[model samples]
Target: MTFTRQGCLLVIAVALASPVLAEGPDPVRGAELFPIRCVECHVITDGAEKKIGPSLKGLIGRTSGTLEGYDYSDAMKTAGIVWSEQTLKTYLVAPRKMVPGTKMNFNGLKRPGEVEDVVAYLLEAGT
Candidate 1:
C-alpha cells in the first residue's frame, strides 16, 4: 500500500500521542494491595504516627530516610536516594539489595505489577 503524506503525518501524530494516552498504573489496585502489603509497616498519611516504618507522605520528591522523627537505619539514611517512581520500583523489588543494612525487614513485593500498583497508591495517597 502506498502511503499518502497526510496518512503518514496522521500516523506519526498518533504514534507520538499514544504514550500520553496510555493509562497509568491503577491506583485502585494499588489501594487494594497497600493494606495487605504495606500498612502494617508503612503509613501514607502525613503527620501520622510512624509505625514499623516511616510515614510515606510526600514520598516522591523526598530523599530516603530524611523524614523527621522516623528512625531510619544508617544505610538507608546514607543511600542518598530521591524517591521517584523508577527509584521506588527498584527499591520495592528488593529493599535490602538496594540498600544494604536497611531496616525494612519485609523481603519485598516480588511482582512488578504489585510494586507498580503500590507505587501508584503511595504517590496518590501521599498527595
Candidate 2:
C-alpha cells in the first residue's frame, strides 16, 4: 500500500471528525410519545412560562442552565452542559447520570424509539 500526503491528511481529518456524529429525533414518533409520557408536567409552547416544569420551547440550541423564572437546582446549573437534541436524548435516557441530583422524578426512558419520539414531539410542539 502507498500513501500520499493528501491521503494522510484526509485520513487524519476523518479520524478527528469521527467524534461528532449527527443524531436528531423523528418528529412523528416524538409527537406520539410526548403526550403519553411528558405532558403531565411540561409544556413546549413559545412564551409559555413554567408549568409543573419549565416550558421547553427553543430547547435545541438553548444554553443548558439559563431559562428564566424557573428554580433549577445546583446540580443542573453546574453540569457544564448545553441543550441540543442530542443532549436531550441522552438526558432523557438517564437523568441521574446526566445531571445528578436534579428533581425530575420520572424514570428515565429505556427505549431509543421512545426517546426519539419524545424529542421529536418537543421539537415540533407549539409551532
Candidate 3:
C-alpha cells in the first residue's frame, strides 16, 4: 500500500493518452477504412484525378468543383459547396439529400459515427 514513481508515470501516461486514443476516428484509421468503404467511387487525392465520382483531394476548406478537369454535378457546383468539417459532416450523413442531383450514387452512410470517421479520414488524407 504505497506509491511508486513507475506506477505514477504509467498512470499519468495512460490518463494522458486515453483522451487521444478515445473512440473518435483517427485519420489513419479512416485511410485504412476508405478503400473498402469509399474508394469504389471517389478518388481522394491532390493530383488531377477522376473516378466514378470526383477526386476528394484538398477537400477540407476547398470549394466544390474548384478542382479543374472534373465533371461535377450541376447541383454540386452551383450549390456553392465548401468542404469543411461541418459541411462534410452534414453531407456525409446524407449525400443525395444534401446535394440534390449530385451524381454520387451511394446511399447515405448508415452510421453517423462511420460518417464522422470517414470525414475525418478524407479531411486529413485528402490534403
Candidate 4:
C-alpha cells in the first residue's frame, strides 16, 4: 500500500477514536447486572443501613471496611484496602480469594467482564 504521511496519520487517528477498538467498562450493563447479582446483599444508595452487606455508596476512594454502622468481618476490617477500579476488579473476581475470611457468602462474579461492569456501575452509582 502506497500511503501519504497525512493518510497514515488520519488512519491512526480514526483507529484511536473507534469505540470498538477502544472499548471500556460498561456501566449500563453493570446497572443491569447489579440488581441481579448484588442488590440482594448490597445497596449503592446514600445510607448506613445494613442489608446482607454494607451500603456501597462512595466506594471508589473509601477504604475497605470503613463504612460506619456496618459490622465487617475481621479480615475485611484489617485488610486495609483502598477501593479503586483496579482494586475492585481484583476483589470482585473472588472476594474470599482476595480477602480471606470475609463474611460475604457469594462466590464471585466469575467473569472478568462482569467484574469490570460492576466496578463501573459502583463507581458511577456510588458517587
Expressed as tens digits, the lDDT of each residue in 3-90 for candidate 2 is 9999999888866664322244567767777778878887877775776777788776776666787787888777878776788889
Q: Sorted on lDDT, highest at the top, how do the candidates line up?
A: 4, 1, 3, 2
List, residue by residue over 40-113, the lDDT tens digit for candidate 4: 99988887776999998888899999999999999999999999988998888899999999999989888546
**In model 4, which range of ten residues has the least summed lDDT?**
15-24
Q: Each model's TM-score, in the order given?
A: 0.78, 0.72, 0.76, 0.80
Across residues 1-127, which tens digit of lDDT does each residue of candidate 1 receive? 8999999999889767765234457789889999999899988877957899999888988999999998899999999999988899999989999999999998988854678788888788865
Provide the RMSD of all predictions against the true structure, rounded to 1 decimal: 6.6, 8.0, 7.6, 5.9
Task: Please write out the lDDT profile of model 3 over residues 12-124, one tens digit for every residue.
Answer: 88767766445676676677778987899888766887888778878887887677888888888888888888888788778888889898787876753577678788877
lDDT of 4 at 22: 46
Among all candidates shown, the one with the greatest lDDT: 4
* Model 4 misplaced stretches (Cα beyond 4 Å): 1-23
lDDT of 1 at 1: 89
Weakest 10 consecutive residues of candidate 3 by summed lDDT? 17-26
Pairs clashing within candidate 1 = none
lDDT of all predictions: 0.85, 0.74, 0.78, 0.88
